[model samples]
Target: MSLSLLTPLGHSNVAELIARRTLTAVFQPIVNFDGGTILGYEGLIRGPAGSALEAPGALFAQAAREGLSVALEHAAARTCVAAFASLGCEGKLFLNFSAEALVALGETRDRTVAWLNEHGLGVDRVVLELTEQCQIADVARFVTAVGALRESGIQFALDDYGTANASMNLWVRLQPDVVKIDRFFIDDIANDPLKFEAVRAMQHFAGASGARLVAEGIENAADLIVVRDMGIALGQGFFIGRPDARASREFAQGAREALDAGHIAVFPGATRTPVAASPSGGMAAAKMIVAAPAVPKSATNNDVLELFNRLPNLHAVAVVEHERPLALINRRSFMDRYALPYHRELFGKRPCMLFANASPVIIEKSMTVEQMAKLLASDDQRYLADGFVITDEERYVGLGTGESLVRAVTEVRIEAARYANPLTFLPGNIPISSHIARLVEHRAEFYACYVDLNHFKPFNDRYGYWQGDEVLKFAAAVLADVCDPTRDFLGHVGGDDFLVLFQSDDWLERAMRALRAVDTGALRFYADEDRAAGGIHGEDRRGNPAFFSFVTMAIGCVRVSPDTRGGLPYGSEEIASVAALAKHRAKQEASGFFVIDLDEGAAQLHLHEAPGAAMPQRASALS
Candidate 1:
């Protein structure tokens, strides 16, 4: 309810409600990001049913206006503690209170403690949330009071951080036990770098201050991964659980799957070159929607005509029934039909569905540009002319033109190609990293093969960079041919280096096949004399003469599985590092292939415990 709707006469109602003790409390669970468990519930208040002050916002607003904020907060605290105790909730109980309410609680400490004991809520299990709504005029006095409360085992949290009056100075002075990041910074943090950085900075601050960070408003899997990866311990949001009189004891299935899926979120990166025109993040359809006026299914053709006449630039009109879209009437088609002889007089009063395509394409606002592109390929191409209706949960919101969908899809396609290697047209570094991250996220069983050229520098020196490019192309083709495109990803990690994430069960055979192909193809790139001698003489980097063998491929394979044996989960960067080590080991072998089975503890032994002796560096293929 709006404050403008409240009157001085409502003062008596507020007093009467408080005197009768009619306040109720609901709880929303706070989840632990790392463990994927409920850490606690934040207690929230609601007023009497069907009243002007039914919402906490309106209730608190009225209380503040009447100078009864402290009294109301105290009564609300009692209600929340009683409700939580009655429900037999576990873990900590967070109760929100303004600075004034906190100071007042400190004055009545003994009485409040006794009151909480009566409701079976210990001071140890209660965490008072101090919002930055009002400034603490007396810092020293407030600190002393908070210190006394802390002595009584009452923890404190700073709410709605990173906005308004929640300043650095206040943080240092109060030194809260928990800091709740405001929704402004937490929303869409996965896509927005600025918000991500802000939360990261807060995470670091919390670490140093010995305080825990709670990311507020985490409503999606992408954002959840970003926050969880950032190491924030606690999260609260509608996606996690909505406020309820009896909140869920466990997380939702979607939240549980996302947290346990082991897939690392694919972070969006800025594309620098024209090779990739845009970033890889999905753009929601809502971004391009036009808020076109829609007509109900009951509307007549003349009504739609009037709407079209009123808005000269309107493309199409959506026919909705009970907020659900039924069809789309293209403006041109409708106008053309009305232009026929005596058509206006004959059918102008008829139902608009006469000209509407009943099978109009309707997409949710959350649909991505890439998803919409797939729809454009469908046999029914009328969406191009009729324009698709945008909806939220199947309820019509607006209209989106085919032109915008094509433009967005084109940009996304360009972005996907941005990381392609110019020499071989294979995916480049970013794509390689993204694919590896995806594999790790899905917990897929795959072999990460790091393919590099052995003794490549001598070939480049003898045959020149042009021939070196040919050798790289040949290697890329061999690897590509060995991969099952439907189950594998091949990427060119610059120069002569390639990475293949093979999901095919016969990855061993494929690796060996590529190696054998490289062995046969290596001779063709060499000079007649070098091919005959099986080697070439070149000056080493130390100025010493050396006999370098003909360029051959080295495949370092590391098997990553869902059942990895380690203290920590495998990350994309860690997998890359492990693969590089395996590649170095492969260079030492004549077979040109080496495998590190993580299940056999070979990775830990080689990468961590052992740290094997130094190996010789291969010559740069680019040089």
Candidate 2:
């Protein structure tokens, strides 16, 4: 069992050493950002004593060329599983498996399961890390095999996400439990704005997909801090712990200590963490209730003019009956609809009198400015109201003017822009959560659509960064235009992604058409050379030839209905959950658009059958 004999003598010797159980396993601990707890360790395999296969990378490479990669992989898996069992580590164990080797795993499935069960490890605790570098020729079979193992508690992960062209597609198709972001992106996230924005967007996408993001190749405290701030749940790098079998126990203890000490920074990249203002510390509470000012339905144009003169801050006058808001009269409406000479005569019969057609923005007493901003941004100009009448149920509580909403929304947008994906200028999780809460309080019917650009990165890679920016801006404009002021809302959730809302189901179809129209027109910006080639040029990691395909979008829609059972309205969190589920379903379908109705009390998923329905249409010649 000398190491020299096992040293790459030939494929036979390597296999013999593996069969003899001479291979050793090393464990590298993956740690949490803030807690610094050992989340898991990636089990790295080493060669037998004195072997030329001393370098793990070279060892695996040589095995692949020699056609013994599968056997070697199995041996490594068994060794790692055994070592994990002996160490009594509760965290997950990540074991690398080449796609080429996974195909053959079917033959050894039973054996592998038995061995894992024989040890303390179960399928759930062991994560199979599939490298994207290898081509997966048969995805269906691969998925079936992995899915079966997953049912037995085994989970799969895509290693080196964003490093390969096929990785993004594989991630969507395979839907792994974890995605290990490549080191190239994480290495300088804190210092490089471009890389930071890209990774942040990736993190948002991962969260939406219900997958965990692990930052790999973290070598310094700075890198660890940056990754943590970016909201990466799991991290593996030399700073946390290097790979070693006997060191696992020590590493776990150290990780726990670090967490307790708060030695790790949560978000190194955040300029500032948000702090809520103390309610009692802000504006003084009114000692007495002031009667809300009112405007009579019979008020003349002269009366309207007098009211504006009396109250300079007068945003709108409410017409009420028995404490119910009947209509809202704005200063501009009266001035535009009535003449000074007819003021008295028009008093009782003016067309500008508060009517059902007059748009009104309603708000609850507890609403924050951030929530109101999202509502304002979702609509077109016609639906713009001066302010919302704050109410509790049917009774008026107070007033929320556009000035107040403007100030509130500005703060929120600034905060959002800090962490938002810069390239796309979309709000991240922080704002989305607030917007959902506000929507729920309103008891409004709104549709939440999870928008994803299909084959975007490939397009980005083919086109330069400038072209990629154009595509993202184009999508943003499309979303803004498609959203109807009377019934819809839209927000940029992050890169190549958007969250759109509509009060009417029919509006979803309309919005889709508009999105398709805009996307089609936007594609023309690509130079003729790139269009003729059907791809753009870029440099690969190794500075090799890189060509990427065109971009398209996939949408997942979910509708949130008003809850009438309780006197209070439904909340945004519920709607967001439903929307996320629908998006997942849409991604699963061949079509790009999928809709789900959560109001049905169960998941009812529907997919739009039109191919490229989300794609923009060709423009007609005019002028």
Candidate 2: residue pairs that collide: 3-49, 7-51, 7-52, 123-153, 124-153, 229-267, 454-552, 516-616, 520-616
For model 2 the local lDDT of residue 101 reads: 69
Expressed as tens digits, the lDDT of each residue in 1-623 for candidate 1 is: 01111123344656667767788899999999777889999998899989989999999898877877767777777778888999999999998887877876776677777777877888899999988694887777788878878888889999999887887777898899999999998898777644665676788888899999888887987777767766688999988888999966987777777676544443323211222213442445888899999999999999999999999999999999999999999999999989999999999999989888998888999776656778768998887777899998899899999888887877776765657676777777666776777666657678888899987877888789998899998998899899765457777778788888887778899999999999888898777878899799997878799998888899988889878865446767667767776787898888888888754434443445444655334322111
lDDT of 2 by residue, 178-235 (tens): 9989888888665544456557778888988888998888766556655654457888
Candidate 1 stretches with Cα past 4 Å from truth are 1-10, 266-493, 496-557, 561-623
Q: How much is the lDDT of residue 280 in candidate 1?
A: 40
Give candidates' CA RMSD values in order: 13.9, 30.0
- Per-candidate TM equals 0.53, 0.42
Please list the C-alpha lDDT of all candidates, in the order they appear.
Answer: 0.78, 0.62
